[model samples]
Target: MVTANKKKIGLLMVLPAIILFIIMTIYPFAYMIYASFTDLDLSKANTGKIIGLRNYLDIFKDQLAISSIEFTALMVLIAVPVEMVLGLALSYLIRNLIGEKILRALFLIPMMVPAAVGGFGWKMLFNFIFGPVNYFLNLFGIQSIEWFGRPGSARIAVLIVEIWQWAPFVFLILYAALQALPRDILDAGKVDGAGGWKLFLHIELPLLRPIFYVTLLLRVIDVLRTFDIVYMTTYGGPGSATSTWSFYAYKVTVSYGWNIGYGSALCVILIIVSAILINTLTKVLNIGRELGLSKE
Candidate 1:
């Protein structure tokens, strides 16, 4: 009876937060769904009406939207895998080195910085005429390249800043996972003449695989929503060349376009895509079982 009462007390304590979530999150999303089917231009708020699937269909016709989708996809595909691999490698590299604790903290400095600030700093660092990067390149007999002037270089610059900021996040999580492994199991592998890469491949990799998939899924979801960095650094230009779906949606809804209905439609599409990707990844990784997310 005491245990059951405690459970009820706990539920009662959390009841307010549950209600707040419904008010704050559920209501807005439900409204967004209603708005997406309308021609709800913010410029003439009261003059809008439902327009069926036109807002969604119009997405393909917009060149900027198409480019933004492509750019967002490119970032997810490139950044997540690279960060995961690089972070895993760094975690292994610093496992037992002298002053490893200090080194780990130092490596995490970039991750600690806010994304907008980091992007702005990188923007200055990559300045064509007088940036430190160009000065260093000059020492190596390379010409100062215009990072922001060209679309390709601007995209690359954004990618580099993202990788620099996020790789440490991946490293921290993976390193913690690596440290939490069973020492006794590792010692047994060492006893069986398994050292170096051999031990890692056969034993450590299998043990670490679940955490890796979880991290990969996290990075994918995060990179898909990247916007702050692009906004700070490139402002979604070299002429909208580096615009992300999130940034573009913001533009359509609030910033430049003032088309709330269209932006809501774009947001709905993004949400659907994210749901599909997350569901697929969860099933393929079988992470639900690993994370005890399943009743089984």
Candidate 2:
């Protein structure tokens, strides 16, 4: 009876936050769904007559929307895998080092740096006329290239900036997982003459499976929503090359015009995609029960 009363009190304590979430997140999302099916525009104070599924259908046909989706997919595919692999390797290297603590702190510097600042720094680094990147290229007798002025180069630039900023997060997570492995199994492997590749393949990699999958899912989800670095560096340009869905959504709401309905539609699509990703990941991890328990 006492436990039940305590639980009820705890639930009551969190009721305000739950109400705020409903107001802020749930209400806005519900409004977006309603607005998406209308001809809502800012000039009309975001009021409009119902238009059915026209906006959604129009979204499918929009070249900019399609391009943004493709770019977002490519970014996730490229950045997440590369970062996970690199971070895992870095984690392994640092795990047994003499000054691992200090080294881990140093590695987190990239993540600590502000996103806009990091983007601008990379922008300068990739500049054609005066950047050191071009200077280095010249040393190799290669022509100076305008990195962000070209579509392919712009994509690469954004990818690099993203990888630079977020790789440490992957490293930290994987390193923690690695550190938590059973020492007994590792010792047994050593006794069985397992030195490097064989030991990792047979033992460590298998143990790291859950962490790898979780990290992959998280990074993929995050990369899908990438905006700030790309925004600061490219502004979704050199002809919409670096535009992800988030940037495209921003353009719809703010830059191109204030088509609130269209922006709301785009946001709805993003939310759907994110929901699907999260659901798929949760199914794969089978952590739903554990997550529920943690909430208690």
Candidate 3:
């Protein structure tokens, strides 16, 4: 009875946070779902009358919307894998090396800085004129390039910035997982004449699988909804070169006058995509448990 009373008090203490989550997250999401089925454009003082599935249909038919989705998908495909691979390599190197405390801190500096500052810093690095990158290129007799003025270059620039900012997170997580690995197993492998590459491939890599997937899923969701870095550097410019769904939505709602209904529809679609990805990941992890590969 005493334990039960303590549990009740603990629940009461957390109730305020639960209530706020419902009010701030659940309520706004529900409201967006309702708003998505309306015709709430600017220049009209209406709360938007219901327009059924027209907004969704139009979204599918809109070339710009299709293009933005494709661009975002492509970015996730490229940036996430590269970041993961680089981060894993860094983690492994640090794990096996001496005097790593400073190196680890240096790696994490990128993640610690503000996103806007990092984005602008990268932008300056790739600037066509008076930038260190161009100056280095000129040393090899290579022509100066317009990094953000072209579509291809703009995409490349944003991908670089994303990789730089988020790769540190992957490294940090993987390093923690490495520390938690069974020391006896690694020591036994070392004694059995296992080379570094072979040991990593046949042992360490398998053990790191769960962490890898978790990191991959997290980075995918983050990159999909990414806006600030791209917005600060390119503003989705050069003919919608680096335009992601989030940036496009912001443009339609805030910058280009209010199309609250359409913007809300975009938000709904993004929510649906995120939900689907989360559910799929959950199923994958459940399968891992059923196969005796991972803990719940």
Candidate 4:
């Protein structure tokens, strides 16, 4: 009876938090799912009529949606690998440095900066008139390049800013993992003829695999949900060149039009895509083991 009462008490203590989670997260998600199946216009807030799967079907035919998905994919493909490689290299270099701790802290400054500030800073730096980038180009007799005024340049600018802001996060995670590595195993490798590139490729890389997968999974989700930078810098401008899926959904619902139902559908699609990609990556990496899920 005492054990049963103790269990009941424990359950009672957790019940409030569970209720709050249902209220805050589960309820909104359920509502959004319901709204996606209806013509829920903000203008006519309460008069939505069910439309079945029409919104889902229409999403494929929407050109901007297609473009946004394509652009987002391109950014993920380009940015994630570059960040991972750079982060790993930097961690390796810094690991052997005298001031590794201070340098690591300094590297985190960019990641600590607010996204709005970082985006605006990059935007100003890339400006054509009186911007440092253009001034530097002028010194070499090259004309000023309109970074955000052209579609291709705008995409490049966004990618550069994103890579700058996020690479440090990847570095921090990988660096911590590197530090936690078994020195005995590494020393053993060195004794056997593994040092430099051979040591890293054969020993370090394998140990770092789990952390790398975790970083990749996180970066992929973050890239897909990229918004503030695009909003503050490109606004998906220069003719939809930098429009990510999140920004496209914003344009559909709040900015360009007030199609709440369609926007909800877009959000649902985004959630589904993110979940699918994360699930695939988790399986490929066997992340459950890394996370200690297999232990229990």
Task: In angstroms, give how far residue 280 of model 3 lies from its true place.
Answer: 3.4
Report the lDDT of model 2 for residue 49: 81
Lowest lDDT block of 10, candidate 3 = 285-294
Question: What stretches of model 1 exceed 4 Å from their correct place?
Answer: 2-15, 289-296
lDDT of 3 at 120: 84
Give per-model TM-scores.
0.93, 0.89, 0.91, 0.93
- Candidate 3 matches the true fold with a TM-score of 0.91
- lDDT-sorted candidate list, best first: 4, 1, 2, 3
Between candidates 3 and 4, name the one with more favorable lDDT: 4
lDDT of 3 by residue, 174-257 (tens): 988888989899899999988689998988888888778878888888988999987889989788878899988898788876
Candidate 4: which stretches are off by over 4 Å?
288-296
Query: What TM-score number comes out for model 1?
Result: 0.93
Q: Tens-digit lDDT track for model 2 on 69-123?
A: 9999898789988999889999888977899899999999999999988988999
Question: Each candidate's lDDT (Cα)?
Answer: 0.91, 0.88, 0.87, 0.92
lDDT of 3 at 250: 90
